[model samples]
Target chain A: MSNITSQRSAPFVVAQIRQDFPILKLKVNDKPLIYLDNAASSQMPQQVIQRLVDYQTNEHANINRGVHYLSETATLRFEEARGKVQRFINAAETREIIFTSGCTESINLVMHGYGRKFIQAGDEIILTVLEHHSNIVPWQMLAEEKGAIIRVVPINDAGELLIDEYQKLFNPRTKFVAISHVSNSLGTVNPIREMIKFAHGHKVPVLVDGAQAVPHMSVDVQDLDCDFYAFSGHKLGGPTGIGILYGKASLLEAMQPFKGGGDMIAVVSFAKTTYNHIPHKFEAGTPPIAAAIGLGAAIDYLLQIGMVAIAEHEHQLLEYATAQITKLAGVTIIGRAKNKVAVISFVVADIHPHDVGTLLNLDGIAVRTGHHCTQPLMHRLGLSATSRASFAMYNTFAEVDALVAGIVAVQQVFAGSM
Target chain B: MSNYKDLYQEVILDHNKKPRNYGQIEKATHQAAGHNPLCGDHLQIALELNQDLICAIGFSGESCAICKASASMMTVAVKNKTRADAEALIQEFLALAKGQLNAIDLIQIGRLAVFAGISQLPTRVKCAILPWHTLHAALNSGAETSTEAEHDPMRTTIGGA
Candidate 1:
């Protein structure tokens, strides 16, 4: 409520923005859709959709290898998309951006390419309790393989990381730190810049999982000085099967290539094979060209709307939703971190989150239920699961009201049954 | 909403609120665990078998209404039936839930027919059938404990049974 006036002044024209996403008009169970599962994946705007169609219809071809006209056009557009991503995150150079399948693959690439090469037995890698399985499992796999120990930074009940404990986790054997910029499960936005700076003080290279961060805020890789950053395209209003991993030039040069394929090598012979340069060295096969371009277009759309305005609008929505939901009896909101994005995870008294989700779906309100791929986090929080309503830029205040009503209806259904 | 009414029928709701045979069976001869990865539902089913017949059955776990209700009705449906008959009932129940077997098949299942509407909820079909699956595993393996694989319901093809 304090920042409500300023937030309203921000250039967030929700009605106009909602018109761009065709899927928002969809009806579910004979009711108007109120999609609040943005944390899972944001809906694509018509501009990005058209860009994808335009790419496929006219500019489609296998990039990097062909000398044909379509191939050249595709290659140029794909690389330009890389440059767009370069500026979107404000990375040092375009060469730092490596395209992969999604955030999961991006992390796996780092774990294999960098962790296998640099980390030694008995070395420690620091991670946090807020990590998604994509961030945790890859490191666990590497730790098991290399006999490395993983030190986890625990969280408070509010779901904020313990900075003091994080500082203590570092020692001479600590070679790497992998952390998320935001918690996808609880919407807790971590103090990534401070964490990255602290890790740097210990000479530990840090990898920031921006899958949940990039779509919500303006992130400058150079400003954070993170050694590596990764995010998924689908979560950023683009198509799936596309993601980017940004690593410093020095780090990329030192690490081995993740996947060996046709496009990854500069020269290949029966006797020997020479690998290609930085970005192409990681992008092994024919990449998702249309998705890459679509992501670039998505970036363009976000830029036009302005990240500051988007953040402000979503913050307002989060505040509004939190206040409204908090007023309801028997509803417990999880993860009350002071700094959070627009996600709200809550459990209704004596009701299973699965039932809540199913019942809410009947009201045409979509939410995510379950542990949200953060089983360890859920275990740490002493919750088996939660129903999460996450907001995006196009989501309206009225939609939040719809969600509250949906919850009330769900409660009625459960209460009456009892 | 009406479509959902078919899934969360009155019988299912009543059973969920006060599930039958809801506690552990300490002297059970067979036992198995069922897990729904999507919703984080955990159920452990134990059966006391006298010869080939299910003499006593109990389950203990935290699960959704669909799962709890399905387990409540399933224990009642298969109790005192021979292992072979129980297995047949399990198959028939799953077939009915997946819409493979029509409502006409419910005559054989008795009160368990309340779960026939489960065919409408493709996602919750797993919740309805998890107990039956656990029972099948317990009766077949003869092991002290059997566990289902962690399945992503979103990726699972409905009626794939």
Candidate 2:
């Protein structure tokens, strides 16, 4: 495996990696597809796709509480996938990894299972402004139901969180802290390890939303010492409708189940019922079997490539793209944080981002254009929406050139009309 | 997908760059704000009605070239026309933009003929029609049409009255 960080002299062979993804061969609007919408959903490689196909073909069975041949095999594979996820995130144990539908459901599970039980009236929950609506709305619902207060950590002009204000928000009433490991809209990589340390000192457990972070860089739940970490598999080149929520074993044992079903209960009767242990307690029903296995395959694929290499390549791409886009006459790049992922959001000479997205699509460059499920963040930045181009390990520098050319064409269309 | 040139024609861009009647009308008879939460396109339409005929009309907002140009052309097209005539023209223009109407006389549309290119870009039809919807809301005295319940094809309707 190539380590782009340590072996800085060697160039990342993006063309070789692009070959692994069959979708890269597709064309849209008579042009080669330049997928810059990885932040929205990354494309799956052949390995994960094949894994899903293999699961459906030979090993199709409902897992847990099965005695038949295929059923036992499916259960073993599902448990093996959980172990893979445990190793992927450096979790303490496989029992700490609970599979949910996606990042939204994972967060909602925490809110309902833990939050509804522990959080009390007038208790303060600390959150950051750059959170996706998924993270914010669930907590807001909790706060509303419990009569709890929610305090936000503001961001500077460059979209980095104000660490000084975040610490000040901590007090006796502070019960929890939920922050994103990376901003999906702005691409700011928040210092989670340090933030978690601060929250731990105040005895407040923190939940790191790692949906955007897990795909870009290596994430270790044990290293961060976060109480919980949530991420979606689809954003990491795995199948959709599957996600992982890594919680501390002690915390998972204490929290109530988010839902009740056949699998999550050890024993059920008319009057008395006992819940299952740790992970099984959280995952209620027959989960997305193929997607979990596919996510395991995705983890294997990512490990083979090495995350440090992906991060380094994506960083170079971001640098190259930022340099190129900054040179454009009317383009203004948003979120200039010192530490960022491979996402770039920008505006062009007061042009609406929708127009930019539409024009980019003509060149077969797919970029996201909207508030990006971060409405409050958009309001904080004084922007209604922005055109965002996010990169993955498979993206080439040539695709960045295509994006710039597409943007220039958009400007020319406006200028020539004048 | 539609060709980029057809959606962003020279006329549309020209109007976008230098939109006519693109300011607030002071002491207007009726005014309303419109927003497209889908794209965050927001516009405010103010109308000065002289009995049933529109005396003066102006708009202000931050939106796409299609929307701005459409608003600019709408104000010019509807000014001095009676409320009934303006409503009729708006229906024809929207139908033409949606590609439902094959052909319409340019004379009837006036300068609004530039919006015929909207038929090509289905996704952008909202940008072309948002201004007219805002105007409709303003003229009808708080009659707002919410698009939240509509199906996928009509999901991009202008939000708020």
Candidate 3:
């Protein structure tokens, strides 16, 4: 193993990694902040934050369609960030990267542009039960408008997708297959490469929602051979209000523009309007310039640290967390897939998830408690909500220990009263 | 991070553990359901009234500690109080939750005062207020005066005086 990988594998060194995130320096309720809610959004690194500050102070101007010095500088920085994203996801070309508000808007762009045009009446779009609302709702809207059929692939008790069932859902009418690369509610890391191949066999395009996956693992769109990949910047140590939608160049050119405004149009007249080319055709109006720059910095930071090392570190943390949390009484870990991300959701017996969350907060530990924007997934699991603790590279094994200790405290408090 | 440890006082924990009137009341006079979709906390509160006073209050649903305990304490606090008084108490609770009042007024509500700590958590404020919101809906739905049982609080009739 590499030195970083070896160092990460050691639990003690993992404990020390907590210092990297500046937010961990503060105290909550006189206790050190033990943030375990990385799946929702990650805390910004000093580097990422500084990048945003530098952009606002030094290079703040609208990108593209400009010739002045500041505009030229801003445009160069913006395109450089796009190039960074192109490398981060291993897309074939820089033109494949289109920036948007976040994962929701990214998915909506595809649904409205590509899905609206291709998905006709009686056409079918297949998705899994593990999708967040962002993935489910946009498709539902498109299906309803186009009179397309929506098919959901069910998950097993362990939260892993039933590949056989997913295949069964595939038909000649299956125009698209939308799936989350890693489930946000459960930590199940889907076999996306095989899934992409399966969809392509049916001649159907696939959109992989990588909001949870991109943060934890190395993603290569070329390797997966997915038609489109989407992820939120905020979930990956970058600023909010920025996300990327990577599509095949040909497919992007074929699709219509999702929104019509400045920057996305090449020419506008009362007589005729001509849309811009490729990526800019999809991005509308004053885009999140500073956020895009911050995302670039975040990508740089992750590349420097190496995603493979981060994945390995998270794997060790997941193993250790699973072992410790499962040992606690009345605590049932939600998902147990063979391959998964670092997100873990669980319910303490007879205790509502919010209660578990509040009690844990008393100890200065932050966790998400709810349906995790996947109500259908919760319904599939016969649960209303589950408390979730997702990990990032900056998280420490000591934070996991603190989580265990906090959960134990909840169990003790509720157990005595009951 | 504030010195709000008293918000999780033993009485609140006790009420949360062995919540009184914590089952569905058959043929309830007034029923209302409240939900905090953000956290997925759902609560259904049923009130049995005699004349203008609340005879009994029972609630059945699931939620977190702050919500469940608040509901449980609410049942005990509002029993036998006039509808107007109950409404006033709800308003007081809302103000306290918004940090407009001190912990002393919250302490007046006994164990329910433990939720004063939740006021510090902006996100969790909704979870603690689920029961109050449901009660408000139930009362406004003509459940206060009508002796007839209602099926779903979400669909309850309103504006009947």
Candidate 4:
């Protein structure tokens, strides 16, 4: 529960949280692992892991089926998890939450369930340059299928979206807006609530990709009024293969079912078929029951520790890391957005990010190095790739120090040869 | 994983710093580009062949040290050698980098043997072998971007880079 409130705070509660994640103690290359790839996927805590073990141990059964004890119990637990997600994001109702495989699938679901149903030829879908491929590609597929035009909102030099350009892109033909809550590559936190409000002003439904944001800060779908909010469970310290898509009740009711299966339909026959209600209509086949329950446990863990504390600790890490990395010569940190998560992406002199990442691994540091599935953003920045070190609540300042030293060592390795 | 010391030895680093024949050749007899979409690596290989002998060879690209070094060493290894020799060496070098060669082939590889560590670094195998892929493409007038079906290890796996 103790978040590092100050820079170099000696007493920290994060150390206790780190104890809850067994993987943090692992060593690589004869050194303690410095996992800075949290943006890629956050590690699971013991609480969530144990929840999975308990579920598989006793509550194993196919949900939404037989009247057997295990089946009913499993179905109850699954619905309970959905309720937890409803409360977690402040969704208006549990029926509005549809479980998917991941954030990508959630976005694809909206594209299939809502987009395919509404979008038409010549309709313009507004997106942003900072969006990960997950957000962009699905819309592109929809546009390609429907002959809809896709317009992108440009970003400023510091990686902040040009709000003017965003609003300018909105017009009578603009039908949908999809934006990320946080930039996976740069850590830029877009003002989703304001952006959603602007989209709503045009009466265009917006989908907020909160996969990167939810892990760092608190999110309220009702407050944002975003028609659809999607995130991956893995990014939120839960198991993979499970995610939640929170859609407005009216929107959920209006959209078509994303997939066809036994649970999604009330009745089926060769002659005619009738679909089921809202959530079940969207959740098609057998869902990832264990992962859903585990995500609920993760929410409990986060609620117990508190998001404000998590955000505060991660911000301090970002501040300290930025200051430390900025002091190093021949290093340039990309994405200097005024508002950001605890992700620092940078370049070392002229060294390729792949090289920097490899050398860092020698010191047991794990950082992501690539376009980060944001190729369009990379094109806009005029860089092929960057090295990104993303912090989680479990990360410590000492790990940040290790990352800096690792970078320095990497530079030395290349510099000596040069 | 191979130690960084072995993976990026002096020869590899020296070539990366001052790569030999690190530029395009005008009116080259053959040319091609290699791309690793996973990590955004690119390199152009151009060679001039006259009467079954490689008279000139050059390359240029934005890639990691392993790739650049391999390209640099490849040009030095094959230049002025016969077309048959260069093509045979290319086969040997590819096998060596993939760790598919025997002791005799390793010895036959000579200076190009530095990339043997690439086989152990699964994530970086593309970076080390990309140049040869381009060279193979250039010699055969193959596609503009010779990915060698890179497998893009990054694509098959999820989580982390």
User: Candidate 4 on A121-213: residue-level lDDT in tens?
Assistant: 999999999999999999999999999999999999899999999999988999999999999999999988899998988899999999999
TM-score, candidate number 2 = 0.93
Better of 2 and 3 by lDDT: 2
What is candidate 2's lDDT per residue for A1-418, written digit by digit as tens?
A: 2222333333458888898999999998889999999999999999999999999999989998789999999999999999988988888788999999999999999999889999999999999999999999999999999999999999999999999999999999999999999999999999889999999999999999999999999888887999999999999999999999999999999999999987999999999899999889988889999999999999888877878889989999999999999999999999999999999999898678988888888889999988999999999999998999999999998999999999999887777742
Q: Whole-model Cα lDDT per candidate?
A: 0.88, 0.87, 0.83, 0.87
By the DockQ metric, which is better: model 1 or model 3?
A: 1
Stretches > 4 Å off in candidate 1 = A1-10, B25-27, B144-161
Q: Which model is ahead, 1 or 2, in terms of DockQ?
A: 2
Candidate 3 residue spans exceeding 4 A from truth: A1-20, B1-4, B24-27, B103-111, B142-161
Tally clashing residue pairs in candidate 2.
0
**TM-score of the second chain for every model:** 0.85, 0.83, 0.79, 0.84
Prediction-by-prediction clash tally = 0, 0, 3, 0
Model 1, residue A35: C-alpha shift (Å): 0.7
The residue pairs found clashing in candidate 4 are none
List candidate 4 stretches off by more than 4 Å: A1-12, B102-107, B148-161
Greater-TM-score candidate between 1 and 2: 1
Q: Give the least accurate 10-residue stretch of model 3 chain A, judged by summed lDDT.
A: A1-10
State fnat for each of the candidate structures. 0.53, 0.60, 0.63, 0.50
